[model samples]
Target chain A: MDLGSINPILLVASIMVSATPILLAAIGEMVVEKSGVLNLGVEGMMITGAVVGFAVAVNTGSPVLGFAAAALASAVLSLSFGVLTQVFLSNQVATGLGLTLVGLGLSALIGKPYEGMKSPTLPKLDIPLLGDLPVLGRMLFSHDIMVYLSLALVAAVWAFLKFTRAGLILRAVGESHDAAHALGYKVVRIRLMAIFFGGACAGLGGAYLSLVRVPQWTEGMTAGAGWIALAIVVFASWRAGRVLIGAYLFGGVTVLQLNLQAAGARVPVELLSTSPYLITILVLVLISARGIHGAPACLGRPFHASS
Target chain B: MIRLEKRPQPSQLWTVLTPVLAVLLTMLVGGIMFAFLGTDPLEAIRTIFWDPLFNPQFAGFTRPQLLVKAGPLILIAIGLSIGFRAGIWNIGAEGQYIMGAICGAGAGLAFYPADSVLIFPLMILCGALGGFAWAMIPALLKVRFGTNEILVSLMLVYVAENLLASVASNLLRNPEGMGFPGSRNFKQWPAAHNAELISGTGMHWGVAFAFIAVILAYVLMSRHIQGFNIRLTGEAPRAARFAGVNPARIVILCLGISGALAGMAGLFEVTGPAGQISIDFNSGYGFTAIIVAFLGRLHPVGILLAGLLMALTYIGGELAQLMLGVPGAAIQLFQGMLLFFLLATDVFTNFRLSLGRKEPA
Candidate 1:
């Protein structure tokens, strides 16, 4: 029952690390959705990135290369999904589920040799002036490069969607692919690019998990984080700024639950562990109940042009 | 350059041919994958696709095991196919399955040491109800609030897993087992055990129910107005709305049926084959059923055949692992490839390949 043992500083620092993966994934998925493509295979791409990232880091003794390899491998994997759903005009929901199956199975096969293996973890990058400060420095300034990169990514996505013409076209494509097609915009090409970007971002997030978060390779390690990211996208209403808030909110719940267990709180361990998922469902219900349905109209619809 | 032209209507020939084509394509590609893995591709392929039911050494035991494996898959997929037909996705059947097993097992355990004839039937009812209740969360939410059922249902899977872990360890733990986390074995409890009706045939109550479900689903989809409504809703929602189809009722019905079936599958597995409720009791039957539903083309008879084929792979994959040391994950990869090829080839059903540049209409 001793709640005082939980340090706010360590909690805040860990929240940044824990939130970074989902933040990266959610922001990327937001862009993809904005382009009117719903790629539900974030879990699949993330797991692929995790295994590739870990394998590369272990072999090369470099986390950066691991991250790059993860992004490349996941982006390549996502293109298969792109080809299937975009070109073949397959049902996006079913195809996305198939991608997850493929990714999970493929990652398991590729990760066999690396099971129970450790990888080179990203070192903390302490900002100069801020790192010297008291509580705020320890909480925010002292973190890995991925944490800051994830934040910058959110801001960058926000600006891109708000001010850029390309972003507007992407949005137009998402809102109504047929209308975008009538405007002579390459709807399929734009969607494919968005899907690729989403895959790469999901991969980087997964790489951060293996290379920095857990610092090891484990089968099925992503373990529904990708789904959580997808939920966060809905929770954010596809806005990049709110995506950051949603990821942090989820991350805070996760970290707090772990801290409670560590401190031997009276609450049952299972209850604490299940809180994040339940909270996500609660948040989704609340958001949807507000009647602010901001989803792209063309989301999850197959596009085929015949002129 | 190659181009695709939309057909006036979907081809009936391709509808039946695509699954066959997808299987062959998977075998070819999967063989190459096996070759890269250092196993003799032909041997691995034979072991996976042939040896389970044909090999003299394994057929006697594996034949019955096929029914045992396929029973839950077919039952769950039957329910899922109905929902999928109506375009209502209840991906959280896994959670419902878990809840069903827990509730069914818990109900049976409540009457421990009592040899009543009613125990097993009561358990089945409880199991279905548990699953139905679990599914109602997403169904109710989607109906009332316009929430995304996919995300909500998926999140519940994790929650269900945690609940399973908790109950297996604490609430349902066998008191006399001295520290092991599991329920009392149902096999030893005669009144509650879902035993095979015929010895050595693997024809348990679950298998019997699955067969019944297949026939019932076939009737419902082909000869019933509700089935017509479900199909109409998916094909043309605005048309369905104009025709006075109650979309909310359809959502509730689809989710409810799927959840209940998935739950019963879990209950049957726990009582018959699984023997006891444990932390790892689920074993992905709910998720794999999704693949079975798709591979069967969301049709009842198709799901029956698809379920059997999928079960053969499960048994054959085990045999392959034992005989050739092929990694267990290879079978999963194979199934995934099958789906991909099916989806890829599905284009032929709606479009024809044009070899030359498009002509003015």
Candidate 2:
């Protein structure tokens, strides 16, 4: 009931922190989708990244190495998906689901020994003069390395998709893979690369959850963040900037729900907790009703070369 | 250079043999994985695939336990296979299952201390309806707005899990049990209890329903118009449309049947083996059903066999954990491999793999 109890600065900071993982994952998935590939194993890849990141950091005493290990391990795992969908011409949807189940199970298996273990903390990057600013500085400037990197990644993707020839080729492949193949663009190869990039990004997001958010190894800790990130890609209409907005919006709901619980609001805690997912679905449905603008035409379709 | 040449028609032999091949590949690969984990590969595989059904020491209990474990999986998988066949992916059957359990348990709890002959049937109806309503969210959204059902349904599972936790803690908490977060044990409620119909055979109402579903589904797919339309839609959407088959009706029918079946599964589990509504009531039956459906080639009979096989793994997984200290997650990884290997080898059904220079376009 007390609006004054909530701090705007802290809320902004929390939103940034909360949104980082999804932003990273969605951004990567956006690239993959742009190349006309739909890899639904974000959850699996993220959880794999999470456990690997946590285990490496704890054992190596280096958070940076943990993040690297996460990216590498998840990317390696994603290659199987690439081989299945791209090379074997398996159904993309089924393969993605397999990736998720395998990733979850594999993460759980490997994470067993590391359960209850604490991870090395990732240091926040406090820019010299801006860190002292009352609101704007704390809201935007003060964050860990990954948050800033994620923001830069958004900009880089936007530019790449708009300007770079490689990005154009990716988009070309996504829009019409058969046409792209006719033009000698190597549709499968491009998609394979995009899938790997998505895997790495998903891994980083998982690493963020383990290294920064929870700072512990637990089974299913990434929860449904991977799915939410997938939804964000749709909600954003495959736009980079909109992805940032969507992630923050979703993150705000998550933070607001927890804030409601902390403030002892009259609403049931479970209802508040589910608000993020409900809102995502609502937004997704509303947008899709009107129809999407930039969805990859070949999204989720498996590519086979020989006719 | 290897090239895949599309066959004139999908090889029918591979269709039957692929599942068998996938199982063998999974066993070989999974055995190697177990070996890496320091367990004897053969012993691990034997324990997981063999011990539960034939081991003299465990058979007395494990034999009957297979049906108990397979009932929910078969029921849910059968439901999912219907939707998946029509390309209407309802990945959130887990959520529907949870809602069904909650709603069914809530319905039964409302008439607590006032037993009636009608209570059990009413619970079944409510449970199925509960799941139906829950599933309608994605169905309606997909129908009305063209939203993707996969993400929406799957996301709802987390929401349902939270709701489950909340309900178990607050609304359904057993009042007489000193503040425990569970409902009244329905096993003790004679009118509500889903007791085993056959002595020591684990033939509860759920198992019977699973069998009934298989028979009905088999009949429907082979002889019914709706079943033909379902298959037609999956194989050729444009042709189905050309034949005046209503896509919207198919979506609703598929999602509805799957949701209702999943709901019933949840209700049976809550009332029978589980015996109460608790926070941890869901043991991933919904998720596991997806694997079962795929493993069974989305066929009713295949799902029945796949469900039993999956259940065997579950029972054997427990045995592995007990005997060799193998982690539970490893067993899950092994089960997931079944689906991965299935899909991987499925390539041979439609195209033959050849090693040569890439075929000229």
Candidate 3:
């Protein structure tokens, strides 16, 4: 029950690490949704990335190769989803759920040999000047590169959606695929790209779990993180900056819960563990109740050029 | 170049053919996958699709287990089909299932050491109500706040899992069994056990309920006004609204039905085969039922057949794992492939591929 045992600096530092996966996933999904596509296979993609990343890192002894392979594998996996939904015009929700099932099964099959195996983890990058700073350096500058990369990605996504014509076109495609197609834009192709990008980001997030966070391979390791990321997208109202805040807020809750458990708080362990999911649900309710649902108009709609 | 043209109406022929086609496609692709895993492809496929039902050594025991496995799947899928028909996604049936088992089992356990016939019926009622109430959360939110039921329902699964662990370890721990994290075995309590009505046939109360649900669902979908409304809502929401269909009522009704069925399935499992409320009582029946609902074309009869087919995969997958050294996860991958192929082939239902170049507009 002694709350003083919890280190504030370490808590902030760990929040960055904890939030990286969801941040990466949410940002990518944001892009995909912005392009008027909803790919609910984030969990599947992330888990695939986790296993592939772990296997590659273990075999090659290189975390970088592991991350790249994970991104590629998930991107390829997402293409299957893109093809089914975009090219074949399958129902997006069902196809996405199928993708998740496939990912879970495939990852488990591939991860069988790698169970309990440890992989090379990502190295932390300490900013030369900032590393020596008082509390700020310890809180932010000393985290792993993925944490920074995820933050940079949020900023990049914000800029891309805000200042870029291609981003606008992507948004246009998402808002009304028919309009985009009539304007001579390849709606399906753009959606496929966005789906691919989403998969890659989900992969990086999953790889972060196995290679950096957990630092070991376990079956079903991503364990609802992808779903949380999806909830974060809704909580953020599909805005990039709010997505960052949502991820950090979720990360803060997760870290705080774990810290409470470690500090032997009076709350039951199960309640503490369940807090993150409950918090996500609460945030979703609060956000949705505000009626600020900025979901893309064409989200989850199958695109067929022929109408 | 090939071109797809939308059919004036959905093809009934393709509707019946897709599931069969999807199964064959799964066997072919799954065989190749098995081959890569160093198992004999034909042997693995045969073992998965054939051995469980036909192998003389195992068929005697596996035959009845098929009913045991399919019973819950059919029940849950029947519920999900209703919601899916109205374009309402209640993806968190797994959570509802857990809650149902908890409430049903807890109710029965409260009357522990008492010999009363009413206990079992009361448990059933509690189980169904438990699931229905759990489902109402997402339904109410969606109706009131415009919340996405898919995400909310899915999120609740995690919450439910945690709650399950908590109850199993703390609230319902078997006191007489040296502090183990499970309730008293229902098998030992004849009053609460959902035992097989026809011994050795695996026909329990759950299986009976599943059959009843199939006929009921079939009637509801084909012969009822509510069915028409559900279909209309899915196909044309605006038209449905114009026809005086209350969208909120439909959402609530659909979610409630699915949740109750899923919950009943869970209660039946915990009482019958599982024999107790444990942390891992749910075997992903809720999620797998989603695939069942889709594969059956959201039709009750289709779901019944699909449920049995999926049940065969489960039994066969286990047999394959034991006999051919196939990894257990391969079966999950196989099921996933079935859904993927089904969705891919479903394109034929509404569109026909033209082999020639498209006509100029």
Best by lDDT: 3
Alpha carbon lDDT of residue A64, candidate 2? 97
Predicted complex 2: CAPRI docking category: high
Tens-digit lDDT track of model 3 for A171-259: 99988988989999999899999999999999999999999988898988888999999899988889999999999999899999999
Work out the TM-score per prediction: 0.99, 0.98, 0.99
Docking class of 1: high
Any idea what lDDT model 3 has?
Answer: 0.93
**Residue-level lDDT tens digits of model 1 in B266-340:** 999999999999999898888889888988989899899999999988998899889899999998889888888
Candidate 2: residue B265 Cα off by (Å)? 0.2
What pairs collide in candidate 1?
A36-A174
The window of 10 residues in a row where model 2 chain A has the poorest summed lDDT is: A298-307
lDDT (tens digit, per residue) of candidate 1 on A132-163: 89899999999989899999999998999889
Stretch of 10 with least lDDT, candidate 3 chain B: B45-54
The collision pairs in model 3 are: A35-A174, A36-A174
For each candidate, the alpha-carbon lDDT, in order, equals 0.92, 0.91, 0.93
